[model samples]
Structures are given as C-alpha cells and as structure tokens.
Target: MVSGTSRAAGNLSAEVTNLVGRRGESAEVRRLLAASRLVTLTGPGGVGKTRLAIDVARRLQSSFHDGAWLTALAQLTEPDLLVPTLMSAIDNGAYESVRVEELTALIGDRQMLLVLDNCEHLLDACAALTAEVLRSCPYIRVLTTSLEPLQIDGESLYRVPPLSVTLSGRTFGAAVAGSDAVKLFMQRARAFNPDFSTTEDEERAIVDLCRRLDGLPLAIELAAAATRAMPVKVLAERARDALTLRSAGSRTAPSRHQTLRATMDYTYQLCSGKAGKLWACMSVFRSGVDIVGLEQVCVGDDLPLEDLWSTLAELVDKSIVNLNGSRYVMLEVIRRYGQERLTELGEEDVVRSKLRSYVEDIVDELHSGWFGPGQQAVLARVLTERASVRDVLSDYLRKSADLRSGLRVAANLWPLWISSGNPAEGRHWLDALLTASTEPTQERAAALWVDARLTLMEGDLTGALRLLDECESVASALGDLVSLARATTCRGGAYLYAGRVEDAMPFLKRGVKLERNLQDDNPHRAVGMGELAFALILRGDLEGAEQVLNEAKAFCARHGEQLLLSWVLVYQGLVALLDERVGDCVALVVDALDRKRAVDDPLGITYAIEILGWASFARGDARRAAALLSANEVRAERPGTHLMRDMPMVEWHASYVGQVRERLGARAFEAAWERGRRLTGADLFDYALAAKVPAVHDAPDLPLTPREREIAELVAVGKTNKEIASTLVIAHRTVDTHVENILTKLDFKSRTQIAALFGARARPET
Candidate 1:
C-alpha cells in the first residue's frame, strides 16, 4: 500500500479484468529491450503505456537472474525520495543502508530489470539516475514510461499507439471485432452490463463512438459504463453533440497524474465556465442522483435549474459523469474533486440545506409504511439508500446547533439500523443526539428509548438502564405511552441480560400489557411480546413461552417481517429444546437461519447456529456438537459476536466441550475442531444445519495447489510477481492469482507466510 510519504513496490495491482488489447505493442517493447540497455515508452495519458510495459516485463522476466521490479513514480512528488524508493524495491523487505554513491555496490553484477513508471514530471532526476545506473551496473536494464523521451544517450524511445478502431473495409463482421479498439469497447461494455450485445446498426454506432474517443482506453471505459442507462445508438447520438476529438501530441503534457485533485485542475481548465459551477454544486450527492435530485439541490442564483441539463451535457462530453439507469454518477475521483471545488465556491451549507429537506421527506415516507403490508418494500428501500441517509446525518445533522430535527430523523431510522445488523451504529448516532438535545420533549423521549433498546441489544446493561431511566421519566412527564412502553421493555431486557430472570418478569409483563392496550398492530408490540416470551422461557414456563411466541410469529407472518420473525423463532426453538423435542428445535433454528440470511443479519445467524450446537450436545452427539460450536466461533469473528458475552450460554461451551473431548479422545477431537474452523461460506451453514457435507481433498491438495506451490517457492526467494511469472513461463496476472489463492487456502495474510514455510526449499539457482 502507498502511504503518505512513499510507495511500496509489490506486484502491480493485478487487473481484475483481462488485458483488452496491446499484444503487438507488448512484443515490440521486448524486442527493443534486447538491443538497448535503457528504453522508454511514451504516450498520451489514458493511452495504456503502463499496462503494456507490465505485460512485456512479465513475458521477459525469466531471462533475468535477479528479478523484474516495477517502481511506480506516479505518486512521488519530491525528487529527493527517488533513491529511497528504488532501494526499497531493489532490496525488497531489507533495511540495509545504501547511499546513492554506492549504486554500483547495490547492483554488484546482478541481472535485474527496473521499470520506472510516470517519469514525465521528474525528467531531469530520471535522466540523471538512468545515466548513473547504466554506467555503474553492467548487467542491469532499465525501462521507463513517460509523456516524452528522456532525451539521453544509450536510450531508445517507443511511442505507444492507440487501439485500432477502423472497420478495415468490412461493414460488420468478425473483421470488425478484430479491431483492438472495438474489442476493448465491447469487453468493457459487457463488464458493466453482462447482457449488453449489439445488432449490426448498433455495432456501427459503437465503432463510431470508439472512433470519436480516439481509441483511448480510459475514455472508452467511461463511455462503456453508461450502457446500463441507454442503448449504444442512443449514447452514440448524444456523443456527437458533446465530444470533439482533439488529437494528442499537439499540447504539452500536464504535470500531475496520480492525484485526482491535481488532475482535476487540468481537467477543469478544459471545461466551460458553466460546467465548473454545476460540477461544484453536484458534489453534495455522494451517491448518484436523478435529474430531479440535481434540480432540487443545485438550483440556485448561481446555477439556474434549466441550465443543469446543458451544463451536465458538457460534463458528459468531457467524460466526467456517467449515466446509469435513472442516476447520473461521477467516478469517485471526480466526485472528490467536485467536493474541493464546492468548498472553494462557499456553498456547502446552502447546498446541504436542500439535501436535509430531501432526506427528511424520505424518512417520513419510510416511517409511515413500517407497520403495514408495505413494510417489506420500506425496508428494501431503506437498505438501498442507506448511504445517503448516513451522509445527511453525518454532514448536516451532527454539526447543527439545534439537534431536535436530527434526533427525529435518527429515531425514525432505527428499523434500518437494526434490520441491517448495525445496532451499535444506531446507538452511536442516538447517543450524540440525546446528549445535545437535553430537553424533555416528545422527540427526546422517543430517541431515549430507541437508544436504550439498541444499547441493551449490544449487551451494555448499565448504559441501557441509564438511558431508559431518563426515558421513563420524560415519557411520563409528556404522557407519551408509546415511549414509556418501549423504555419499560428495554429495562426488562437489560435485567434479563444481567441473568436476573425473576427481577425481569414484572416489568416485562407490564410492558406487554401497555403495548397491547395501545395497539396490537404496531411493530413495538411484537418487540415487547418477543422479550416477554424469552422471560417466560427462562422461568421454566415452557407452555406459556410457546403461546406468546406463536402470537408474535403469526403477526410476523402476516406483515412479512423477516427480521423480527427470525428472533421469535429463535426463542420458540429454545422452548422446543427444553421440551425434549430435539428434532423440532433443529428445524426451527434452521428456518430462522433462512430468514436471518435473507435480511443479511449475520449476528442473528450466529446465534441460531449456537442454538443448534446446543441441540446436538443435548442429544449426546458429542462430535456433531463440537463441530457446530467451533463453526459458530468462526462465523462470530465478522459480527464481533460471542455466545459467552450476550447470552446465558457461557457455561454450556465449557461443559459440552469437556464431554465431547472425553468421547472423541484428544487427537480426534482436535481434528474435528480444525475441520470446523476451516469451514466458511455456504459450507459452514450446511454443516450446522446437517446439510450435505462438501467434498474436499486432504494433504498437499488441501493446503496448496501445484501452481501455488511453485509460485510460493519463487516468492520465498524474494521474487516479485513479474519475476515469478518469467521464471514459470506464465503471465504476471497468473502468478498474482496463484499467490492470492495460496495465501487464502493456508489462511495467511501476507507473502511472509510463504517465506516462513518454503524459504528453505528454494532452488539453488534462484
């Protein structure tokens, strides 16, 4: 990872997609390197020079004895850090101090290839270093990427050309697809929309679009991603009105490449005056917005509402914004630049006020449908736009002087915060709101109980009690029964979490009665009923727990409430387990798991898995019990959930494990434990629910594949991806993929694990 001060040279970030074109350029670069010690690849920005160089290095790496290293200089600004950066990549994980004067000693006759990328800005420094390096290191070769030639002795320059986009005398056939530019455009368009395909007429439109973009890879990719919004012919028609292809090599290269802010300065210099203002105002939307959202926020004295269409068209012409379905999206780089421009224009507060109103309207619509048949739709919509809601709360609401409106918004959004398995996050927002708005109003009262409920769910018994005490008093003062009932239920749940079952009964009973009298249709009534059933189960009232759970479950079934229904079944499963109906208990938990998984509630899934583990232990299947419990621990790592922390099941783990160990013996029990830890994805759930076991290999096959082992051996000897690919006669991408799989199969995080295990087994020649 590149930090604030320096760049770490590792494998080039492996491209997730295939290399679209440039095969001929890759081969040509290799031939040039065989004749000259120093070669430079020059091209316009976004023309694919860096990718071509990486491909060439990967093919030629095996010939060199030392290694091939790509030192990206795109982010390096200060010329003084050049030597430190090269030394780090050359020495690779070593701290041996070597001065610039000792360049010959550092090289020492080793045959290595060095690829210095993005050298146009530091032309003088690059030339000075290249001259000194070629003179000192007799066996080393250097490759560089720049906007112009380095203009030095012993150097050959190769100017990379754009991808071919001509029809080649064919109207539309395989000959047309043979053009590198057409192939790249089709591949990138399908990557954005897998269903994208074209008729002959549409193919002509695509070829026209590529020709208009000058076959530049970056420009083509930006246009390709917009296929989801409109047809190719439609976009091509729009492109003619916006784009005017200016050939490269006419103007001098800009100084910045790596940082978007610096690149934005150059891009903004090219934009019209009206487009810049519209770009700045549009920055308030983190997620993409429709035309209506743009008009709602960006319409002001400086930017009229009607001007949005034309100014936005100019930006699209510049390939800054992409349209996806109903939304106009800016790439993250351009959006960050737009934010800086928004700050410069001094309209952040004015723009955010419009956003605040938009979110307020959205939340009000979301809350109104929470108890009816549209609840599922409401929850789905909440999940979809969760990012915008969070942005408004963070940017505008938190910094406001009066937090009453903020509190109202936050309190109403508790369903999303909980259904998304983010109760801890909900508590964070509510805690801030409660502290700021200390007045005892209806909004504060509701926010207090909401905070208390989330706090109790997170196992903070003391904190939940503190919030609920204030809530009870304020709700009583304001005569708000809804808030009072919610506080009472949370107080009971807090006591239950503390393992004081008898102390929880009276409060839970009163909460249920108050909720029922108020209205049985509210979601809070179901919440109270679920807690009251859990209290009944803990007190040995099995029959009573079943009756209460059935009622809540029926309510959930009618309203399509999967999240709360999952919880109701969890307690019902516990009641069945104590009733000695073991099969029923497992079936119930499995059903709950399906519902929890649907809502993406991982914590709820973990709890349900634990209940099945307990069911297995009670039936005397100690081996199955051990496996299920171990799998739960593995699943628990993501949600940061622990059976010992929130539930009264702490003693069960120790007691069940001892019995399991005695039955299976120490070694066999350890084998089972390791097997369970290795389970993940669908396999973990399958094993817990007694689904079919996934067939897997053992030994060398289980730990690493043959290709992975070969790569690991090369990696152990300090070879980077380019070196490994060259030595193994494979592509650099292939080597990176094998290394990633090796690490994942062995459960290792870094290549250091490869070095630790296979370092001694490296070949003598390497």
Candidate 2:
C-alpha cells in the first residue's frame, strides 16, 4: 500500500509525477530498512538519492502505525536547531524549549520511519540526535540522505548510482524506450511538449545526450525541459551550454531541485568560510585541476595557501567537488553555479584576470622550453589547457576595449596556433583584438605581423602582404625595432610564397641584419635566419644558403627553438638533394620530421614530409614520394590557416606532383596517394618514422616553485613588494628575497626587465 498526504501524514510532498527510475535501488533500500535502524542514502549531488529516499518512505508508510515522517534538514543552518526541527516535524504541539532528552522521551514508543533529508551539513548534530532516537524508541527507523555516510554504529549505507542508460542489441527506438535515463527525459520532455515524439534520429541524439550528461536524473530532466523549443539534436549539440539553463522544472518540486543551478546552489550554501571562496575561485579552471595549479592561481584575497587543501577536502565531503586521483573536478552544472556565485560576489573580473595571467606565464615558459628534450611535455601541457586558454583569450578580446594583454597573448601563442592546428582560432582572436585596438602601440604592431602570418597560411598572399605593410608602417612610426624585424621577415616570406623570390631578398636580408644585432635571443631571429637560408637556396646561392642555415641552427640550439630548427633542416635537406647527396638528404629531412613530431608541430611536420617526398623523388623512388606528398596534402585540408609558406617547398611540391603522376601512371599513383591521405597524423608519423611514439612525461627544470612563480607573476603585474607581501600574507623582506631570486634565476638585471618580459607597466600610487 502507498500514501501521499503532504504535511498532514509526513513531510514528504505528493509526487506530481512518478519517479521514473531507481526501482532496484528503492527495493534495496526497503530491504535495508527492515534490518537496520538507520539506513542512509549517500551519493553526489543530483544523483537522485533524495528522490529515491522519499519514494522508499512513501512505499513503506503503511507498515508504520505512527506513519512515516520527514524533517528536511537542508533549510536548517545551525547544528543547534536539529533537535527542535525534528520535534516540530514529529508534532507541532511540542514546545520549542524541549531539549534532546525531552524530545527523545516524547517520541518514546512511536513506530515510524523518520526521513532525514540532507544531513551532510549538520553531521555531528544529526548523528547524535539519530543515535538517541533509535536507542529510545527502538521502533523508529531512520532513512537519511547525505553525500557521505554518518559512520555511526548500526548505520546501513546504500549508495545511489545514476540511472542506467547503457543499451545493447537494440535499435535506437527500442533503446530509448528501454533506458531509464531516456524514459525520464521523454517524460519531462512531454510535460513541456505533449506532442513530442522520438523519431529514429532524435532517439539516437537523445541517447547520446543522456550519456554525455552522465545520466544524472536532474541534468537529463533539465535538458529534456529545453526540448519544448529545441530539437533533441540541437539540445545534444549544445549540451555544454545547457548548464546555464534555468527554472523549467515543476514548481511543486523542492526549490533546490527545480533547476540545475538551484540544485547546485543548495549545495554551495552548505559550504562556509574558505570552502565557499575556494569553490568560487576554482570556477576559473574549465576542467580537472591539480593541487599545484590551484595553489598557483587561487592563493590570494583571504584564501591563504595553508588552508587550501583542507577547504578542498571540505567541499569534497559536501559533494560540491569530486576527487579524480590527484586531480579535482567539478561537474559542469556545479561549475556554472559557482561561476554565478563568483559574479554575485564581484570577484569574476579578478579571477578572470588571474587566469589570464597564469596562462600567459605558462605560454612564456613553454616558449622558452620549446627546443629541449621536454618539448613533448610542453606540447602536452598546452594541449591539456587549450580550452581554458582559448576561453581566456576570447573573453579578453571580445569584451575589453583595451586590447593590450589580448594582443600580446595572441602574438605569443603563434607557434602554439600552428603546432596545435588552431591557426583559424588564433586569427579570429587577432583580428578581433586589432579591430578593437585603435592605438598603434608595439603590441598592435606585433599582432598585425601574426595576423599576416596566419593570412598567408590560408593561401591569401595579397591580403597577407597588405597586413604586413600596415604592420611595417606602425613599427616604423614607433621605431620599435623588434616589431619592425618581425614585420619585415613575415613580409619577405609572403612575397616568396607569391613566387617573387627576387622581390623577397631585400626584405629578408634587411630583417636578418637587424635581428643579428638584437641583444635578446628571440625566436624571430631564428625565423629570419631560416627564411633567408631558404631564399638563398631558391636563388642558387648554395654556399650562402649553407652559411645562413648553419647560423640559424646555432641560434635555435641556443634558444631551444625546435620549430625553427626543423625549418633550417628542411633548407639543408634541399641543398643536399641538389648536390646529389640523396642519402644524406633523406637522413637530414627524416631527422627533421622526428623533431617536428616531438613538438607536435603540424605545419613544420607537413613541410618536412613534403621535403622528404622531394628527396625520395630525387632518388628515383616515385611511389614513396607520391605517398609522402599525399600525406602533406591531407594535412592542408584541416580546419586552419596553413603555415607552410615556403616558396621553394611549394614550387618543388607542385613540380613533383606532375613527375610522380607521369612516372607511376595516374591510376596507380592516385591509388597509393589515396591510401596515404586516409592515414591520421599519428598514424602517418608512425608509418614514416617506423617507431611508436612514447608518452610524454613530466619535465624537470621548472624555473620556479609554484608559490615562487605565483609571487613573481604578481610582481610582473606591477604589484609592489609590500602589496605582494600583503596579498600573499608574506613579509615584505620575503617578497624582496623572492624578487631578488627571480631576477637571479631568470638572469635579469632589473625589475624593469622582468616587467618588460611579461608586458606589465608599473602603476603610480594614488
């Protein structure tokens, strides 16, 4: 038998709709209650534990003569109120002055099931009161829901798993109809749209949507409610965006569970002090974050580093955060909820700025380490945080009129954009920033040069040359030697790509000469030197090309410039091929291909493969040459601006295509080329190198400790030593020591140089 009388019989509200899943879980809870005095339903937030507990209590109410009663503990903030709240729920006539002993005696012989919802916040109070009630009454069974077990004696814990969505050996329609996740989705979806029907395609999309949402009941329901206006396919495509969806649930439901954000907001309200601050600050990370990253980015403004781990643990106990091995993660809905709270507290801008600064530091370190044995590690780290980096750059570019940091960050990540096959995204950010920035500062000048490079990669030679002219004009007006050198080099490369080798020589020569005198070992110098070598080889100046190539190689070796080194090797390989050292050419280009692969540099690898194909053709291996050329062409079709702008390589590839076609006949060569085109980037490298790539490991020689780096970053952003000391809670002398250590470690002579390196200017005191 079942009953639903709302507050009259118990605190359990009448179900507006039947609970759609958890039949097995409900039965197990019933069985556990028969033998145990206390049965707790424990799981993460939004996993249906509360709903399942309510369902179980409703089903077994007839067996208890005093009836099943519920005392919702989520609303009670103080632990001291636990006994009074329970006494009121059991009987309104009970006096407010009744203590725990009096309440226990008052409930002495009642045969009832007490449903305690959300006991995680008041664990000690709840545990003490529960133990006293069970000992005194003996007939009252307690059913509680919490994120963690009470760990009291005689407590039976039943963890509620999410609804099952895994379907096998069934058609799409059959799977949707059978799945508990899909059934709940369809039920809620129909509430908003009665005429809704799951067609074959929509069924498949819904199944994937449920799986992507982790089959959490509330998330599925929230997504289904969105189907009132959008198709299932559209909902699936925008699931990540659905985290922001609000208030589409039944009004009768608990205010917390009525919306996804409210559900998380309830959990957030349970956290106090440092827990709340940590929760808000962690929203800056888009994915899993380790303790080291949290310490680096979240250690300021009332959240000291000493309290971070304990606060994180507190949040984990409340189920607001999850622990995945060494890393911590928040569910998407929870992250959005915290983000909303962060905005409410007016810390959104501060956190966003800190996040941007952290990413900038990461990019700077990666740039410095690009040519070392740890190149692969650097690539992996950047790829891991690529989404967050993109979000930071996009936010700064689109929302801010002051394009200082946005432009510089975009310019600094040029190699990343090329290596990660995201030049199109890079170009989008650069273009937006340039449009917003009216001042012709050196930052804008540098942005224009990067913009032109991406433009040239997309086969837009004229547009690229026009942007370069603009860059050169800005640089000349400001007399920014660094910007001028970059612009000149990019302009010369653009002309070369347009098949004007002679027209490119003067710019290349001038840029190389200017870079040679610069004090810093900038990567642009390696770029200029490499391009000059390529142009010399195109003009039949072999000795000049060899000397330039050697210079570029030495410079890259000093600066750890792996990408530029690969370019130099390509030119050397071409020179060797022309001198009839086919074996040496093959060996050099193959080694260059390996180096490019180490850095995961797609553009450099493409150029190397094309050169290797040309070398193979020179050795009379048309089949091998055709296959390699086809692989390069496949990469060119990816969703980005191509960075292979070398005119000599381009012209050679065009000529080789015809030679391979005539030599192997169209049909056979086309067949082999198609085979190569189907290979993925990793698979192509495996085939070319004939070796399995090892997993990237951690790199030693991190320049500073996480805390020291955090302090240095604060210093770079123009914080005075005293201000830094106050923010991080260190002494003024400690800040001075850290700053002095930073200068010594980075080989900088003054704080001004550190500021210049990180693109920060000191602010005047008020």
Candidate 3:
C-alpha cells in the first residue's frame, strides 16, 4: 500500500472550501505523480496551482502509506527556519526541531506526497531542501507550486493552464456555460450574493467576463465579487477599463500577473478611503487574524475601531479578503499587494510596531493565566494569531529592537513554547534573545527558567541544569522570589526525571515552600506543589506525598483546573498503591485517566494506565494484569506503549513488567499482550477503563456462489469477459453468463460500479 516504499501514512487535512473546477488538470497531475518523484505545478500567479495540487493529493493520498501533507511556506521569511517549519508541518505539530537527517530517516522509504505551496518567495531554499529529500527519500513524491519550477534534476514540470473558456470570434456562445471558467465565475458570484439571479442572460454576461479575464480563476473571482452591487454585465463591461488602468507591472512577470495586479488595483479604487487604509493595515499580518487582532493592529485614528467591521466586510464583499471561519485572510498574492500598499503609505514601521505591542500584551495575558478554566481557550485564541505574532517578533528581533523586551515576551509564552508552540522553536527564540542580552535582569532570569523547563521536557538534564544555574544566579542577585522558585523547582524536576531522588528532595521542598504561599492565583504554583509530592513518593514518604497531593488537588479545584488536577490524582494513586490500598489505587488512577483524556494529554493518560496496571498486579490478577498490560490498543493498538517507553516514568514500569512476566509465563503473557494489540477505538477505552473483556464477532458471508464470486473478483480487477474466461479456463459464453449473473445479484448497472464496490479504482478506457 506504500506505493513503492516500506512504510508511514499520509495526513492531508480536509478542505474548508470546495474546489471549483480542475478535472482534467487533476487527472494529469495524478498521472505525473505516478511516473515522477518530483512534480512542479508551474504557472503565473492566480492560476490555482496550490488548490489544484491539494485537490489531486487528497484524491491520491490513500495510495501512499504516509499520506500527502501540505506545508504552507507563505509565512516563513527566514530560510534557516525552513527545515524546522517543514518538519513541524509534516509531523503535524511535533514539538521538537528535527535535523534534516532525522527527518529523512523518519520518512525513510515511506510513500508520501509533500505539497510545498508558495515556493516563489523561497525558491533557493525550496530547491535545496527538495533536492536533499528526493536524494535521501526515494519513495516520497514531491508536488510543489510556485510562479516557476524548483529547477532540480529529474524534475517533471507541469505548466498548469488556466481553466478553459469557450470562445466564438471573441464573443460569447451558448456552450460557454459548460466552460470551467464560466462555472467558476457563477459559483463564486452566487456564493457572495444569493439574491443575484443566474438567468440565461446572467450566464452570457458571466461567460463574457470569464473570456475577457482570459479565464484566470483569481481575476474571475474578483470580478464576480462585485456582481452583488451591480449586474454581471456591468462588471464585465468595466473589466477592460480596470485592466488597462494599471498597464504597469514587472516586465519579467507573466501577463496574467499584471492582470491580477490590475484587478487588485481596480478593487482598491472601488474601496472608500477608510476601507483602503484598513485593507493596507490588515496586510501587516503574515496570515489570518481574528476580529480582536484586526481591531488591535489595524484600527486607529484614520480607521476608528467601531467602523472597522464595516470596512472589513466591504473588502470581503469585493473578494480582496476572505472570511475563513473565525479569521479574516487575504490570499498570498493579495497580501503581497496590500504590503505594497502599506509601504507606499509609509506606515509599515508603525503598523508592524502595533502588531508587536499586540503580541506582547497577548503573551503577557497568557502568562498571567493558562492554569485555570479559561486556559485552553486563551491558548487557542493566541494560537489563532500565531503567524501574525511570530512575524511581529521576528521583525522586531531582526531590526535589533529592545532585546530585553523580546526576551520577556518569549518568557511569558512558556505555555505556548513548552506545551504547544513546539518548544524547539521557543528555545531557538530564547537562545537568540539570551545570547544578545547577557544582563542579569529579572526578565532574563525568568527566560532562563522557562528555557530550562523546555529543556527539562526534552529530557536534556545537563542542559536544563546549566540554564537553571544561570536562572538561580540572576534571580538570587536580583532578589526576585518568583523567578527563584521557578528555577529551583525546574531544577528539581530535571533531577526527578533522572531518578535522582535524594538529589531532588531538598530543592523540591524549597521550591514548593517558596511558591506555596503566593497570593496570586498562578497555575504554576499548584503544579510546583504537585512536583514535590512526586518527589516525596519516590523518596518513600507516603504520608508526606498524600499531604502534598491533597494540597495540590485543592489548589487546582479552587482554580477550576483539570490538567494539574489530573496529575494530582495520579500522584495520589501512587501513594495509595504504596499504602496497599489497592481499590483506592484503581479508582484514583482510572478517574485521573478520564480527566487526562478530557484534556487530550497523551502522556498523562499513559501514566494513569501504567498506574492502573500496578493495581492489577497487586490484586494478583496476573491474567488481568497481562491483558491490562497488552499491546492490545489498535496502535492506540498498544495505546501508550511508545510514549510509555521513552517517558521518565519508566522507573516503575520496567520493574512491574518484570513482576507480571514472573507471575505469568513469558509465552502466555505474550499471547495476552498480542490480544491487547487487537483492541481499538471505543473497545480499547472500554476495556482499559472498566476491565470489560472485548467481544468478538464474525463478518457476514458474501451473497455470490463460489464460481460466480470468482468471476466478480475478476470483473473488479478490470478484466473483460474474454480475459475472465481465459483465466478461469472456461468457455467465453459461460464467462459472459457468469458476469451477467454477478451484476444481477449486486443489482449493478455497470462493471465500473463493481470495481468501485471492491475498493479498486475503475481504470479508464485508454
């Protein structure tokens, strides 16, 4: 199933909007992908390269073991960060930076398609990276879209043509309704303005507009957006005037690029002053932004906050901006035009500064909260604007702005950086800021501990200790108790991860003591107390551990926090297990696992499952313990095996596995573990949480008799009656009779239907 490779699976996301028209092009792309490892869909801007590539990949994703994944490079301005960005996108938000070697190895010989969108801005980097991947990964097919090709060896270039438009002596025809361009125009036009009637006259006007725009999808879309306010004929008649007004464009660029720019120019002219200004301001964002982000960054003296919504809606109506779910965005090319407008207005620096301030305020708010009920919502809100925020920070750091301010922003984003933002990127930002600003300020002290926490999460014990050392030194000198507490606890966490219980005990207690009495409702404070409890358990102090966890749980309950609350329960379960309260241990861990699942924390859920296994072993249910411990999760087959193996919680896991092995003979234990691997989805959850044995059932029999079934299989494989007769060593007449009976039994109209039913793509006539 991996095409030609050994392993991995594709992970293409579902499209938010329907693809208008690209039937012929999609088939051609599939054919190209079948033969070529690297296919570049090259065309002028606005020809729908990105959309077509994604559509074709979606159709073909299942054929590759590792499915097609798209990496949108429009936001990445730094070439050095390209590899990490690629890794993040392809890995679907893996929280670490992967080396080029590691990336290729992880994808080694796996069949997948990598769709690189908008490579025009970073052609050299895209080319180099593409070359390296194709060299190291023989089975991965690369489909890239750009204004031009990546220009590498063995590259197959598919010059994507504009959607077809029927022409009759430079005039409209009745057949024009069937044209791809006309269909696209009608669809976009009707979508924006439901009241706009699509009569035969309207179709004629749409056909004329499509033909005049040279059948370019983007130009057609822009023209169609104006149909709500005026007739399609009006927009069609005005098209030539708009196209010629902006006759100036890059000579090297294609004519379609000029046409698109001219359309943008006309779209801009149609806007009121306030609308135009806000549109330009909105360009400062690297990607989409929510309403709050738009108001904070775009609205000011020239554009009042109250009037911002109307102006944004105006642009959206004109098709210059698109409202995608909660965020407003301009297409990459549209964003570029807006950026030009921003620069022309001489407000680029001021606008970028506003974005930086907005990001700073957001991160500060996130830092102040994020351990309570609103935690997930706040994190998601900021993440929605991550691209814009990251661009602002990158712009600030590049301009050599206040290094300490940047460091503070990075420090405040610990939740994002460590838990969500791919801590590797956070480390990179912090490392850059830290190297630039060596002064032992309170900001730097805070950044040091946050970076240490990230390193601790990464299991980099020595690196964490080194950062914590600097953090302690700076905080001690500055007399910042909060920073000191963070650093001390983070250091203890590192030692605890390494199982250095005695080495961790003193620092854990001091850290908890320093943070426990803080008046503010900080989430980190409760988590710190919970860490001390974990250290106490590892140190053989059950009562002390229980007392600490009870306090941690109460603190979290007061804050309405479930994540840290779940951890408190896990710790309590450990204490109960050590106290020989087997029922309490199972109840506590199962309850914790339920909470962990609610928060979507894979590691936490795995920890709860492991603790539950310990309870099973204590009860002398060796068979139940083996079943509980089996790799039975359907890859969820062994629900937490991979994470469990690499986690620092391996301290007790190996010892327990040895105990279970000693109790059940190795062979019988292996059989139970294999059974565990067979469990998936709801069944796995049911058995894991309640010890309900999974039920087994057999599939229903097929309707066809043996010989008729054989004939049906042949038809599904695209064999004709002649081939079926030859293969089955039967008379041609008999094969035909069998085929007819098979069709009647399935109530099918065509052989293609049978092929589809069997999950085989019906091969087309040559």
Candidate 3: tens digits of C-alpha lDDT, residues 1-766: 2555433355666776588778889999899988889998876557788889999888878778778888887667777778888888777776345567877886788777898987866778899999999999988889998755677898998877678886434445447656889878777767776766766777777777776676777777667766767776777788764333232223643444456676466457657798889889888876677898888889899998889888887776455676779888765556767888999999998998889888988887787778888877777767877887678667757876578788888888887765452667788888888988888899999999999987766667889899999999999999989899998888877887787878888888888888876665877777788888988887788898888888888889988888789989988988998999877887788788777666655556656766776776786555446655654232322322333433346646667778888877878678656755664544445455652111101112546688886777687677999998899899999998877886677555456545433421122111
In terms of TM-score, which candidate is strongest?
2
Q: How close is candidate 1 to the true structure, as a TM-score?
A: 0.58
- Runs off by more than 4 Å, candidate 2: 1-44, 50-117, 126-145, 148-184, 187-195, 199-215, 226-252, 288-293, 324-327, 364-383, 394-401, 617-621, 640-647, 691-766
By lDDT rank, best first, the candidates go: 2, 1, 3
In order of appearance, the predictions have TM-scores of: 0.58, 0.71, 0.57
C-alpha RMSD values across all candidates: 21.7, 17.4, 24.5
lDDT of each: 0.74, 0.77, 0.73
lDDT of 2 at 89: 86
**lDDT tens digits, residue span 101-131, model 1:** 6665787787778899978767788889888
Task: Give the per-residue lDDT of model 2 (tens digit) for 1-766.
Answer: 1235333355567887889978899999999998788999987778988889889988887777677898888778888778888888888655455689888887888778899999988888898889888888877889999977787899998878778998855576665678999899999889888999887888889888888777888889889888887888999998876555554747656777776766776677668878888888898788867787788777886888888878888877777787888778876667766787789889888887778777888777676665555666776777777777887887886676547888887887777776676678778889988888868899899899999988887778888888898998999999999888888888888887777889999999999888877856677788888878878888899899999899888877876667778878877988898888877776777788877776666677777777777765675556556777888888766655262455566667788899988888877788758866876656566444421111011112437677766776686677899999999998999889988987777655565435423321122111
Query: How does model 3 score by TM-score?
Result: 0.57
Candidate 1 ranges with C-alpha deviation above 4 Å: 1-252, 255-262, 269-275, 290-314, 323-327, 344-346, 370-377, 396-398, 637-642, 691-766
